[model samples]
Target: MTPTLQAFVLVSGALFSIGLLAALSRRHAIFILIGIELMLAAANLNFIAFWHFAPQPHQPTGVMFAIFSIAISAAEAAIGLAMVIAVYRHYHTTNVDQLDQLKG
Candidate 1:
């Protein structure tokens, strides 16, 4: 692979790993949601990068998937935030550690 492709893959890998780490380390519901968003963005970046470098006529497929993924991520964030608000209203906290009622 070319240096540019190598660099893009490396960056995407780093971003994915960091996002995963952030998601695993956070306890606050909002932070966890943000981490998930970051992961989705990293995946989208990887898709775009691959499409740009891949030597195939189907390169646009990756871009289309990235667009769909972005839309889905936006919807997920909206729904997740609404759920968080509802949970906070009932529990008075956004920390996941305090949500022990669902532990079955």
Candidate 2:
């Protein structure tokens, strides 16, 4: 049987919670980036779920938004990763706390 709206919402909530926890608790820049990506995925999941349940799914607005979000997320990931790499090269560590010690 197909999953219900509540099920999708619950899963999305779980994903968001996990992402939030990871993002807040992690000390590595890469881990934080991963957590942010997870959070974005959760948002995308919600968009898809709502779109599937909408009365006018044929309108495609929700789908378009989701696609745009995915594109944005990809760009975000690229920029975040590049920053992480630059920080790592300069600091010789990926730890978030150590990043503050970077000097010009």
Most accurate candidate by TM-score: 2
lDDT by residue (15-78, candidate 2, tens digit) is 9999998899999888898999999999999999988998863788778999999999999999
Colliding residue pairs in candidate 2? none
Q: What is the per-residue lDDT of model 1 for residues 1-104, given as tens digits with 9 covering 90 to 100?
A: 44797788888888888888878998999988888888899899889988998886664888999999999999999999999999999999999988999742
C-alpha TM-scores of all predictions:
0.89, 0.92
TM-score of 2: 0.92
Off by over 4 Å in 1: 1-3
The deviation in Å at residue 77 for candidate 1 is: 0.3
